[model samples]
Target chain A: MDTLNYLLQGFGVAFTPLNLALAFAGAFIGTIVGLLPGLGPINGVAILMPIAFAMGLPPESALILLAAVYMGCEYGGRISSILINVPGDAGAIMTAIDGYPMARKGLAGVALSISAWSSFVGGVVATIGLVLFAPLLANWALAFGPAEYFALMVFAIACLGGMVSDRPVKTLLAVLIGLSLACVGVDSNSGVYRFTFNDVHLADGVQFIVVVIGFFSISEILLMLEESSIGQSIIKTTGRKLFNRQEMKETNPSTLASSIGGFFIGVLPGAGATISSAIAYMVTKRVYDKDGSFGKGDIRGVSAPEAANNASATGSFVPMLCLGVPGSGTTTVMMGALALYNITPGPMLFQNQPEIVWGLIASLFVGNVVLLVLNIPLVGFFAKMLTVPNATLVPGIAAASAVGVYSVHATTFDLVLSVAFGVLGYLLRKLQFPMSSLILGFALGDMIEQNLRRALSLSNGEVGILWHSPVSLTLWIGAVAMLVGPPLLRRLRRGRAALAVG
Target chain B: MRAERVFGLVWLAVSAAMAWVALDLKAPISYEPVGPRAVPLLYAGLMAACALTLVLRPHAVAFHWPHGKVVHHIVVSAGLLLGYAFAFEWLGFPLATALLALLLGRVFGGSWRTCASGGVAMGIVLYLFFDRLLDVVLPLGLLQPLFGG
Candidate 1:
């Protein structure tokens, strides 16, 4: 009953004319950005953030708008994947596997519609999960001491190590690099400068928005330039733009299962939409498709990953809002945005700022509906966005990124820094290093250090106190298990595959 | 594979330098047992370990490098970007942005006419959008004298 009242009040807040308009505009822009190849939600949100701030939007309004964009990107990613076999974002990689095949089989409309509907289902289900589980998680987190927080952070990093990339060591390297970057500027506790290197700009620390825009938007521009495709060929829509009743019926079960799985996976720290969708697709293929038609244009193949990825996208928000820990690179950027508003997301957020929290949740419901409506009747319009030449798009993105970062402080230093990070990001991508872990580590580094110091101070420097409490112990054990589990699971799966093949 | 080794060595040197610098951190009052240096030092050590692993058992994958004209394109694009950054404040948002876009358009295979018009149009539109609508004060530079206060 209490939750119901809060939700109703949230609806009242979200339904206001200004907020509704912002949500619609955010969804529209997010969808367009997401439709562009090599530009995803992270780029969209990061590039737009300074503009949002410069416009003097209320923190809640800005968050609502950005969240809408985040959700819209999930819906928009599948268009390029299905139409041209080119994933618009990382999460849509699996979508292209089956979605493009389906498009080739002349079921482009069926693939697009089914994936859109599946994405809607996943997003809605995850939002419901967010409302129910976030509060409960926040309540539980209230009892966490510094030791527990430190342990939990360690666990989160371990989970990231286990899940984010094919090689855990590479992920760890990325995390360490991020932590090193985070060490720059003046240390708050002791007021000591660490790695400023006598530069005035270094005194304020690297701005999260600059780093995000540099790493995502700038690097993406460079990569697009490297490809240098003047025009991309896209598959034409031969069939109906809407899925048939039979196709809908066929995909329902897979969609539901993927939604559930994806949401759970999303809620876990370090696990994101990419992994969730991959796992959900694999599970769906194993259970539902006995004919082995999954990669060969099976509708369920399109449905499963689409649902899971969207669910996971929503699910990633759980940790960010509830525990103040971001689960992915994108959510980390969002958390950075919240920090700009002087709001730290965690247990106290629920008690203190119900309007912001509940309003965001309510806006998700509205945003997803807007995305579904916008995607179905107008997917063709979005597909046409593919025809946009790389020359104009790449330079345009670079100019926007430059201008956006410059607008923040009007500093030439930040522009230089952004370009530097852009080169670093390009090299990292070339080396197959997972960028998310670096961003996550950077976002969480201060908290982890703070918690570690507090815990040690309280325990009189006894390291054992870190593992003394039951909560801390549980988290430590979870971290250890996460470190050991992935390789074992991989071996087991590989052995099973070998047996099946034999 | 050789690229991985080079990357590993570079990271190793970076971590070592980080740890060395961390040793110089001076905290006046010790309110906590672990000071700011501990975390960075720890990260540096872990990163060293990872880099060592990469050096020892680097993944066997080919690193693709751009060739000939593609390399030229990448270098030119990067140069254009850097030039844009250097010229951003001095040339103002509109002119610098327009020039960069024009060059990039030509590099991206656009006809000279299309590139010229597109660059100027996009620059003006973006300037109007950011400066007028969003209230962001983009640097007008040389254009300021022409527009007048």
Candidate 2:
């Protein structure tokens, strides 16, 4: 009864004229951005975030809008995958396997429709998971102490190391770089300025928004510029409809199974949408065994990955809201946004800011609906957005970015900082380092520092205090698991190699 | 391999520098045993170790540079950003933003005609959005005489 009442309040808040309009606009723009090649959810969310923040919407409303955009992108990305055989995001790669084949068979419209519907079903189901699980997890986290939070942060950073394709050493080094960048301002606790170099702007620390825009947005722009003419040109449509009822029925079981799998995977600390989608594709192939038609214009194959991808996207938010740990790059960016609002997203959030928490949760339900509605009817229109030349797109993106940053401080210093980050972002991307981990580290740095300090203060400097409580002990174990698990897995790989060589 | 080594060496040097700096700091508090400096130093040491591994591995990983035109695009984009910074400070937000948008849009591929028209429209919408809707204070710059911002 209490939950229902709160949810009702949440809907009341979400239904306001301003919030509704923002949700619609966010969904619309998100679809267009998602349909564009090379700018996946991480870049798309980061690019639009500055503008949303500049609009100065309250945190809940901002979250609502951003969440809507994210959900919308998950839906819109499939259009390109099916039509052009180009996965708009990495998670969509599996979608491309059968999607393009279906398109080639002139069932593009049917494939797209089923993809959108499955996505909607996955989203709705995941939102149901969010409603039921987030609060319970948040309540459990309420028992955590400062030492536990410190341990959790350690676990999060370690998970980041374990998850990326690069060596754990490199990922940790990248995280340290992000942390060091975070420390380049006034010390929040001691108030002794650290690494500001006498620059007024550094006193506030590097804005994560600026870093996000620079690394993800600017770097992407640079990379896209390089590929200016390499990729396929805008695909011409043959006015073909999508999958039929029989095709949808064939895909139904795989879609349902994958969504369930995706949600479970997404709830884990390090496993997110990309892995879920990959696993879904494998599972669909293994279970259905359609004589290798799986990857070749099989509607079931396309549906499985698309459903799982979007479901995992929704599921990844669970840990962030409940445990203050992000499961993937996109949610890591969302964490950055929450930090900007001075809102910490762990157990205390549920206690201290129930309205914000529930409001965000409620808005997501609305956002997903808005996304499906916006995406389904406007799929062709968004596909047309792909036809816009990069020449026009790049500059307009830059302008919006410039205007957004200026709106924040009205200072040229911020703009300069943004551009510098852009260059840094470009370099990082070129090296194939995970950009999202840097954002995560930067976002979590202050909280981790504060918690570490608090834990030490209470324990009178005894390092043992970190392991004193059960919660802290468990979290420490988890952190150890995160750090040690990957190397162990790597050792297995090496063992296999040695056995083969022998 | 070259890129990884470059990044690794830089990381190592930076971590070493951070360690040195951490040593110079006052501990979290005088009585605090573990000390504020310990974790940071630990992190720095860990970073240095990782950096050393990168440098030691020393593989010439595939280095793919963007084409020359793309390089030009990146450089020009960066330059445009720098220009926007200075221009906004001197000319004010609305005027600077409009002019920057106009120039960048044109360079990116917009027609001169569309650039001029779209620039004004975008400028006005931004003004109303920020100034009127959000009550954010934007620089009027010389536009103080015309729009009286």
Candidate 3:
């Protein structure tokens, strides 16, 4: 009842004229940004953050805008994944398997409609989960100490290690690289410059946004050059009817199952929408075996991953709000944005800033509704965006990015830095290195360092203190399990397949 | 085989340089026994390890040099950026952007005519929005006279 009253207050704030207007505009723009190739929620949010800050909206309203971008992006990313064979982000990668096939089968309309519908349902379900569960989770996080936070950081890094490909060690190296780069500016505890190397810019530490833009966006531009074409090969898309009763019935079960699966996966540290969606697609395929049209344009295949991805996106917030730990790359960016706004997310957030928490949560429901109405009716318009000549779209994006970066700081130095990072981002991407880990590492580096220093300072530099608390110890165990378990599980599955063949 | 060793050796050298930089910090602000040098030094060690692995891995990882035309595209892109940087400080936002955009647009498959017209259009949009509407002080350079220096 108390929570409900607080939530009603949240609804009141969210529905205010200006906030509601921001929510609608944000969702609308966010969907378009998400639909654009190579940009996902993280980039979409990061790119638009300067504009929001420029507007000088209060922290809560700014958060509402940014959060809506995330929600809208989760909806928008599926379009490219389904119509083109390109996943905007890893989470959407699974959506591509069945989605592209569906598009080719001329059911692009059916696939897109199902994707939008399932995402809306998953998002709404997750919002309810947030309302009911986040407060309880926040209460649990209140018990954490500095030691626990240090453990959590380690767990976060380990979870990151688990998420990458064959090179777990490389991922570790990347994390170390990020942490080392993060250590560049003057140490907060110690005024000593660690790796500034006599540059004035080094004294202030590397900006997380600069590093992220360089590693992901710029790197992507370079890699795009290697590909034969800059845009999708235009196809005559088919399927005009949006949805019928039979189609809805076919998807509902998979939607429910995947939503549940995605929600749980999302709550886990580091694993995110991409993983959830992939797992859901696989599970649905394994269980249903519905004529095995999964990879060949089956509507259920599209529904499963889309539902899972959106649900996981919502679930990812569970840790960010409740535990002050971001569960994915986009959330890490959100956390960084919050840090810029001087708002720390944790257990006390609910008590200390109920309106920010609940209003933001309420806006999510409203954002999804706006996304559904805008996405379904206007999808054809967005799909036409794919037909934009590569020559025009690429340069336009580059110019917009350059303008956005410059607008943040009128400094030519920052543009130079953005360009430099963009080149480096291009190269790192070529090697199939996970840039998410790098961004995550860069974002979390300061937290790890600050917390470790604080905990050590409290314990008079005794390293054993990090393992003292039960919560900290358990979290460390979980992190280790996550890091080591995935590969082992894969190997076991492969072995089982061999045995079965024999 | 030797190429892998050379690549690893260069990384090792870079790691050594980074380690030296890490060692050269002034002093700690608050007393922690290890100071700020510990993490960087740790990175130095890991970088060295990775560098060693890269050099020692004998199984050939195929390295393909891109075609000359592709290389040209990359060089052109880099050159455009370099020009943008130099031009931005001297010519300011409008002219510098126009030149850079024209060059970049051409390199990325735009025609000279397209580049020129697109550059001007892009410049006006940026000028009005960034400088006029948003109160951004873009470099006026010679244009400063017209806009009140």
Best of the candidates, lDDT: 1
Across A321-370, the per-residue lDDT of candidate 3 in tens digits comes to 88888888888878877776778888888999999899898888888898
**DockQ per candidate, 2 decimals:** 0.75, 0.46, 0.44
**TM accuracy, model 2:** 0.92
Write down the lDDT of every candidate, Cα atoms only: 0.87, 0.77, 0.77
Native RMSD of candidate 3 (Å): 2.6
- Using TM-score as the yardstick, the better of models 1 and 3 is 1
* lDDT at B9, model 3: 80
For candidate 1, write residues A1-502 as lDDT tens digits: 7788888888887898989999999988888888787888889888878878878989889899999989888888889999988888778888998899999999999899899999999999999998889889999998888899999889999999998888899899998888788889999999999899999898978888778877787777667766745556799998787898998999998899899899999988999988998898889888988887989999999999999999999999999988998877788888988888889998889889999889999999999999998889888898888898876777789888987798778888888888888878888888888888988888888889989999899998999999999999999999999988998899999999999999
TM-score of each model's chain B? 0.93, 0.78, 0.82
Give candidate 3 regions above 4 Å deviation.
Answer: A236-239, A500-502, B1-11, B26-30, B50-65, B130-142
Q: Give each model a TM-score.
A: 0.97, 0.92, 0.93
Summing lDDT over every window of 10 consecutive residues in candidate 1 chain A, give the lowest-scoring window: A223-232
